[model samples]
Target: MSDYILGSHQPLAASYPLALVDLDGVAYKGHLPIEYAAESLVSARNSGLALVFVTNNASREPEDVAGQLTGLDIPTSPHEVMTAAQACARLLRSHVQPGAKVLVVGGAGLLTAVQAEGYTVVSSTDDEPDAVAQGFHPSLGWEHLAEGAYAVSRGAIHVASNLDLSLPTARGYAPGNGALVGAVQAATGVKPFSAGKPSPAMYDMALEKAGVSSALVVGDRLDTDLAGARAGGYHGLHVLTGVNSARDDILALPQERPHFIARDLRGLLETQPEVTRENEWFICNDARVRILDGALNIDSAGEPDELDIVRASCNAVWSFVDEGGEFDNTSIPHFSTL
Candidate 1:
């Protein structure tokens, strides 16, 4: 809350040895690659940042996910991909015995990861699974949730890949794994230990596997990606190409605030200008933003980069919020062009 947002004198590629990147909104939107995602990541790689694709999607295997990225011109291998299913499997390993029967409430990704980790995957409560692992799969039905609930109610350890409420799709946002997990929770009145974003285990595993001391977490979601970075004690880079908005960053809860914000992945190459406060004005590059009478104001006179204005606006609003001030969010300027 004390303006921990950072500016970079050196490009992120030079400063961080690895980048733990999210897959859904940052690299691709559903089945399609987001604009400039592939090329910018290639640039980051060329600048010496090891790119690791981390995702909460548990429907597809790592091999299949890597193939999708390759088709998008990203050129990735299975080893470079880490899924929520893998993380959930790791958590399950610690809580349950090796080769234990585990109920899989998701799809091939979750099933494959659990098997790779020495768990016997089962589908029904009749298997009397030792634990239940749940993840997001488009094909999930009530039967899957019923099995998970039955397993949990009968005293099996429950673990979830992630609790993301919605999944981004080619059409629009759809129910994600969290929504499905809720069904089990509602039936049994029990909660699951999540293994994905905002849970340090996933990022911790990614960093340990990469063998890097310093890494940057890059993603499009505030509650998951950015919040996970904070929980893991790492810097987070937030991009506007995803579900969150610039105003969302401004009004974010402390745990969900990002260390840096950008319009897209191209921001990785550029140096971030400092957002500093001078009296009542918060400035970033040529943009000046301030709050007056509970309303946010931005100087439209200067031809500052649109992203710079967003940075300034967020700084001003966050500073105000930190001081126990409140304002109408609608009064905040929407730099939608960014």
Candidate 2:
């Protein structure tokens, strides 16, 4: 794998056969569609690229998630959605019998998935379940977590649909399934095997469902989406529509850097500019950046495109850092420039 970001001479929609898209941040935030998300996705689909919505969310059934998309003016179907619940259920099938009892500590989506895999869904440790599956649900309380802890303490294999630390809500960030999983871990001293992003399981299932040889993984978060793509040996495109900002992205660790960065889904239509080394500088579009005496330097103010500046900065910074060089914050670009 290359340490540098990947480039595309052609528009991403034409270069890749499919796109595995993350939901919350990339497609929408809360109940509203992100700016230009619906239009870009529609355009990408029209350009002959299959779009599969992949999410770490495990609380809602596929149809319900699809309905949310459709409601956002983005035409979608349940078949086009893939959830962490599915991956968790698939994982459970390997460790248990065809009809083993599974204690559920989440909501309808996770419950439905476990049952779909031919497992009996139970609600408590008293049932002596063969395994325990936990996910996010607003109704989940201390009692449910206690049940998961109790079940896991009894030697039941624990699986989490996802371990996302926070969930975006209408108000702000709220505790996600990972927080609940942490509570269970503290009580039972067992860390549940994660089945979502940053794990290849969900992406593997998504690739199969999309049935494409080449795909681009698109999302807002680097740790889950980009890191997951790197783990799965696929190209990743980062969008700045949610969670992480351009400034945050440029400073990401090597393993979490995306192959491409964009302002939004609209990036699908544009050719990814190449960041090439020239003398002592790395250039993208018109922006040029270089490291000088342990500090980063902007050799030229060349581009009006904000994304290009980020791209150029990432290339320069990453290239230096990967080579065991230290960063000097004096050269950091203004946040607004990013």
Candidate 3:
């Protein structure tokens, strides 16, 4: 098999008017905005594009995720978000009757989201449920894994919020929802139906909620957001501030590679075909600095010095974009100083 898979070229005209920004590494790791992420969202909204915060973090519900963004000064409503939890809930509701007992193995958010969807939540200590919903959380135990396996072995529908094996964190990489799903599958020898990023169901829900055509999916991880965008026929923008940070990381991507590469959410908002030259500096230090508009730009500034420059430039570009600058090419020289 080929190590590198070049993505199909998607022109700007084919891009969507909606923007899907991942919260966990793209916009913010938790509740706080990662540098210029808040400003970027504001700019996208002002541009008349519908913005949806699409995340694979099953630990929080849509309302909670929206509230977290709003608290961080990023304007968002619960309806303006799509989450793995919501997808799992919708999938369950479609397959099972309302109030069907579901054994939940994840976070409180997953439990609450399933219940909100009219499914009756059950615990491992309770009788075996009619379905099993798996979401990732830090406190998952071996006992819960056994229960999930038991429930699935009993012929319960197994719905996984996402299949992301790892999650980005300030501390470092950590196992995610997919880890728990793996444990259950190992025990029961059954794979689950995933309803998260990279799944068309989640994107369909988001588009339906936003009532928009085409979308720009922004994410830190290439595996999920980018994959989902490709499957859903949307443009994808990969940000370096979140998870994967090198050109090699993206060059080796399986199904989803970004149509645009940015330093963060801020860089994406400033992204335009006309502004391609200005944006080229953001990824200049990346190993795979491709020639776009005769400019040498890297996939991501992964070096120590370049990382700092990317962050600072992302912040400044966000400010300029917010102020209505028309994609001037002046900032390229200044970014080189960092």
Q: List the residue pairs that clash in candidate 3.
A: 16-214, 16-215, 283-298
List the pairs of residues colliding in candidate 2. Answer: none
True lDDT of residue 24, candidate 1: 89
lDDT of 2 by residue, 112-210 (tens): 999999999887788999899988999998888888899999999999998899998767789988988999999988878988998877778877876
Per-residue C-alpha lDDT of model 3 across residues 34-117, encoded as one tens digit per residue: 888788778767766678888888887778878888888897888887778878888897668988899998887888889889
Error of 2 at 45 (Å): 0.3
How big is the positional error of residue 144 in model 1, measured in Å on the Cα after superposition? 1.6
Superposed model 2: Cα runs more than 4 Å off: 301-304
Q: Residue 242 lDDT in model 3?
A: 72
Candidate numbers, best TM-score first, in rank order: 2, 1, 3
Model 2 local distance difference test score:
0.87
What's the lDDT of the predicted structure labeled candidate 3?
Answer: 0.69
Residue 151 Cα positional deviation in candidate 2, in Å, after optimal superposition? 0.5
Candidate 1 lDDT for residue 134: 95
RMSD of each: 1.5, 1.4, 9.9
The digit string of per-residue lDDT tens for model 1 on 1-338 reads 34357889888778899999999899999898899999999999998889889998888899999999999999899989999999999999778988999999999999999999998888789989999999998888888789899999999999999999999988889999999999999999988988998887778887889887878999999999999998889999999999998878888888888888888998788788888888999889898989987778888787987778778877787778878888768886657586
